[model samples]
Target: MVLAELGFDAGQILAGLKPWVECESPTYDAAAVDRMMDLATYDLVAAGATIERIPGRMGFGGSVRATFPHKSAGEPGILISGHLDTVHPVGTLDVLPWRIDGNKCFGPGVMDMKAGNYLAIEAVRKLALAGHETPLPVTVLFTPDEEVGTPSTRELIEMEARKNKYVLVPEPASADGGAVTGRYAIARFHLKAKGKPSHASWALEDGRSAIAAMARKILQIEALTTPDCTFSVGVVKGGQWVNCVSSLCEAEVLSMAKRQADLDDGVERMLALSEEAGGVVFEVTQSVTRPVWEPSSETLAMYDLARDVAKEIGFDLTHGSAGGGSDGNFTGAMGIPTLDSIGVRGHGLHTLDEHIYIDSLVERAQLMAGMLMRLA
Candidate 1:
């Protein structure tokens, strides 16, 4: 509990976080992500951590690993995961000011999750300054492409996750200020349809319209969803002009299923519908970004540890699930004891009005520091 007594400089942390919000590290912008990675390395090093940048497989944006190695070896290391990418395009930070109105601070990537990244660094700094030796080695992993899908860093995350006993993901706390205990599994698919184009007014009957075929498939896909399992056609791009028949159409479908069986069934139904549209050529690209985090004995134990730490610091903590996914999903899928959403609480992620609670910067930092100390 003494770890909770170590006061962190809230001003300094916020100052660091504000400038970070200015960095436009969107999913596809590799150069911007690389810059953000450098910033993360610089911040962690200033916090007394030994930092290294692990090169990604295909020369994409790499992940940064900062370690506070214990004096003894063979201790299970704790892997703390967060991402550097936001969904915003370049120059969004200037458009969204880092202004505080009452208790809330509004800015781009403020809550989801530039603030989380800063909190993780400050927690380690507080523990180091307090001379608190952890029971395990602490390693913080910041990936660059999590906002899109962790295609670049998945292998590295999985590799480091297996080396650790526990994985703590600081992916912005829930809207109600609760920590995340579980997350729904996401199966995303991009469906493309191809057909013959013809004149809209003349010879329309001779043309096999791809857009029409896609509409039928969409209806069938919508019917396959249930309460426990949901599906949506989030993106659709096709067609050329009003006077011509649409020869191509594409849609991006996102499926949130409780179990793999449901996911498989949904996929099967979608593929079958594509096959049924005989006139159109269909292609589906599937991506399982995050596996569902179901409550288990190990996860419950981790939650108990967090709750005990929260009580020691006079903070009330609760656990729940979210529809979103994080690096925690990868570790949870590997059966590691993982706890997520331990960062500052805020709202409007992936939007223009995203912000973090001003007070949460210090409070969540204290909470994470306490959890690290207890877990250590």
Candidate 2:
């Protein structure tokens, strides 16, 4: 394989990726994510790429934009995109410690993304070391808040993507070693339930508990799930003291739909949920949203390029629309040709057992290098 000819070393790649996996960059922790950005910046600099850092906004960590030097610099080229944040919070390493068992390597964000991002970095680094210039200039954008639907970075993502000819997302490859051509539309909502506070022992009957009201709202939100649109409550916070009746409760809700119209209807229904139950008022506010990206002819053509690369690398690549949303959603929805989930192959995403196959390191790196060299 060309990876072998290029001296791609799985051991070296895994060693280099260990620090990223151990970084523990949960989306909400700006400091942790910034540390990750710092790490990536250091690598890009060593790869001889010019670096631009955009400080975080909307209470999120900053983003990194690295541009490789080429004769076609300042022209439309390939945009290599990914995120530094993982859904697993800090200290998840205690349970999902980095370990290599058989062909699988385990860590908090190994499969979901850290490995893929590292692969992109390594591909550029190695290609530079080999003195090979890609047919087009390459730019890298690493965001810090994709885990929360990219509330702060969506506009930045789209803006940077608009300057590129194509976008390659290093999200985790599918279970069947496939790529992502389309993504479901996703919406987020903030829910609040308010009630009268009183002494629980003396006026429990007189006071309406917001926690109880929130519980009822959760059930209602769950019942909104269907074959077309699915809703779930992911975060909830309520009472502060046991002796007092809770006056306020809050929750974060997420909804996903295969079609834009279904997601629109779901958002309407979610916002229409304002009501008062026994003096406890329930209110919902829409938050960040990801528009549905149906596979366009351009996107399918990009996937074909990826498939051809995989075949040359001695593997078969398949692609389909997936449920989870990535930064690809923004680029694809904007009608930019995008190939996503073109990272390492693995499973157990967003779980304690998240990991990647050990051998996929060089294979994916080869595919990335091929795309960089072949895309014009």
User: Global lDDT of each model?
Assistant: 0.81, 0.93
All candidates' TM-scores? 0.92, 0.98
For model 2, the stretches where C-alpha displacement exceeds 4 angstroms are 1-3
**Regions of candidate 1 where Cα sits further than 4 Å from its true position:** 57-60, 199-206, 240-244, 276-278
Clash totals in order: 1, 0
Q: In model 1, where is the ten-residue run with the lowest total lDDT?
A: 269-278
Error of 1 at 72 (Å): 2.6
lDDT of 1 by residue, 103-207 (tens): 788887778888988889888887887888777889899988887668778888999898898999998988788888788788878888898899989888878
Candidate 1 C-alpha error for residue 71, in Å: 0.5
lDDT of 2 by residue, 212-328 (tens): 999988998999999999999999999999999999999999999999999999999999998887999999999999999999998999888888988988999999999889999
